[model samples]
Target: MAPAQSGAVLGLSLSLLLGACRIQAVKLSSDNLTPTVMEFQSVELSCIIKSTKTPNPRIEWKKIRNDETTYVYFDDEVTGAFENRADLLNRASLMIKNATRTDTATYRCEVVAKSDEKTIDEIKIVLTVQVKPVVPRCIVPKSVPVGSAAALYCDEKEGFPNPTYRWYWNSEPLPEESKSHPKYVNSSFKVDPKSGTLTFTSVVKADTGVYYCIATNQAGSAKCEGHSMEVYDLNIAAIVGGVIVVVLILALIIMGLCFAYRKGYFANSKPSTSYKTPAKPDCVNYLRTEDEGDFRHKSSFVI
Candidate 1:
């Protein structure tokens, strides 16, 4: 009786263990694996999975770069190649650090049970990681004064691959070295190759005009709307200069008139003394007097 009882207990334990080992069904649901677009240094890719069966089933994460296949994430024990670069999130999620264009590929998640049959389930996702400079709308200063610096800014928040940024003024593209315009030609105007942020140290009056920014990538291209740039105090200066010139001209005209009047008045009015040798006849010079008319001699100075 004792032996039979012992045998019955062993059989029950074996039955329980076998029942626990057997897998009823394997259900798999993947967290969204949408591709992300970001700058070169700012990319993270991860996937979540929910398994209804055993929590510790053998799992594998694969990458399909170009036409090649590579494993980036695995079960609890990640491969040495992806040791610090990959992480497992919670019960069923995989994360890749610092994702790049090279990391873009099709990934797979697989799970297999420990049963004798070794049934397996799997799911695949495509991830495209983008890495490039950020480029955004161009904003120009209200006014750029001569001998002063003016700034042209491009927002660096929107783009994919990211993008390469270039600025244009009045439809003409300015190179990195042209310094004809002093205020807007400083080194600060150049944007960082990796990032698309620019600054103008000083702006000149010639810098006033319209400006635009262009963003491009291998995938696509775009351009920002043109913004206006104006010069300061130009109208006031022109008005003042014109007024000064007109006043000077009027003063010269008045001085010339006064000088001509003085010359005419200062001229001598004396008669010629050389002609006194010839005398006129008295009879011809006598005035006619008739019917009690009297002649009055009025002295008229002709000197």
Candidate 2:
């Protein structure tokens, strides 16, 4: 080969090696593991790029939850959903303020180098947001007929680690089986601890009182409002008695009417309704009799 051609080939090889060395020189690394944080607090996740092939490596952050991986930071700005509470530092870490349970997810920090046409590095951080259970909402029957089914419902939606629920009767925790409460041997009911439901297959008269539901989690516990239940038995015998009394009153009225009708007690007392007298005039006028002819009566004295 010619000396000039050989020199050109060698220079090209050196340049390729130098470029490879520059890319290898970029040191991007971070060691962040699963971290737990309380609600309404600040947390920082690190993804340090010790060195980069390019002087200006762009930083990006994304969140992974369930089936979705969405951008948290892009183009040197936090996205609209997490704008106020999220911040980036030194192109390697993310700071979040007032974290909530909804913010609990896996965060990924990705660094990209435009000059090297490569992804510098990426690190994953798991974040868990611990939150206490909020007050539970409950519903129960105010009253139910005896021998009927009754159900009480309770739920606590605002909590982390999914709260476990329980039921209480008269301020005492009610068990699934009546045998747990020795004093209430006749009680027949079932309670689900997770769902906080109290159910009775056949409510009895004794099952009439206020009840409560409680929700608990790793952070704390909470309770729902009081719910009162009343079971009553229908008194058919009293209703029958009332019907009999009403029938007797109606029969007595009917008997009195029949007897009065048979005895002509409704007849009119007088027959003068069809016989009316003629009207008489207050003054009577009569013509002078002709027995005294030409009898004139006049005032004679002029004085």
Candidate 3:
């Protein structure tokens, strides 16, 4: 090739390189896409601008939760609930202090570089703030009859990720299956950790003890106050005797009623034998006879 042609090719190549350098695209990324932190702790959401020509890019942060989006950082300032507790780190990443359960959501870092070929870029990071469980409410029966079924319950609503449950009897942790442990061999019970329910198929006197429950999560654990339960024996013989006595009394009353009916005690009385006189007739016939022509008359009453 001629020297002039080579110089022309070199100029074209330099121009193409300069154009490529001027049109650098804006790209966003993060070291950690998903971060988990405990409640009331500090967390850093790392957002990095990989490539951009614009020196002063407009940065904004948005939070999405339950299909609702809200601004966390806008107009170069933290807004809303994060006004005082959040700040921008390295002009791109987000720094949050005293993170709470409500802060657990998907956070987006958006950058707008008008001078770049790709004017916008965004990165989404999921933040999870785990909350510790609060004290659980426990229900234990104070007294249960032996050979009867009994149920105990424990529950709490404040924990994140839904805490699992553990039961204790007399300050000793109870196994998930009573039959699996030799200590609880005499007790026929089952425990449900997710639902916090302890059920006994047939309670015995050995099952009587103080019971408590603990709720645990990734963050921490909390327990409920202990409650006492007592299992007592049922008096089957006494119950049977009472039932028999009641039946005997009912039978005696029925027999007395039948005897009274047979002896005529409740029969209707006969009417008195006093006589009633017959009423007199309402009409009578009269007769009169003339004896002679001397004007003498005789009268007689017809019966």
**Global CA lDDT computed for model 1:** 0.63
Q: Is candidate 1 or candidate 2 better by lDDT?
A: 2
Candidate 2 clashes between residue pairs 3 or more apart in a chain or in different chains? none
Tens-digit lDDT string for candidate 2 (55-133): 7778889999996999999998899668999888667688889998888999888888766645467778899998998
- Highest TM-score among the candidates is held by which one? 3
Best by lDDT: 3
Q: Worst lDDT window (10 residues) for model 3?
A: 294-303
- Candidate numbers sorted by TM-score from highest down: 3, 2, 1
Q: What is the lDDT of residue 189 in candidate 2?
A: 87
* Candidate 1: tens digits of C-alpha lDDT, residues 1-303: 699999999999999987665544454566566656443443334434343355566667776666777776654665745577667766446766655566666877776655425457677777766544344667777776655655566665544456777778789876654455564444334554344444566554566678887777655556778888886655778899999999999999989888987889657798866755566444343345786555434344223
Please give each candidate's TM-score: 0.38, 0.61, 0.74
For model 1 the TM-score comes to: 0.38
Q: Give the poorly placed runs of model 3, Cα more than 4 Å off.
A: 1-23, 245-303
State in Å the error of residue 298, model 3: 43
Q: lDDT at 90 for candidate 1?
A: 60
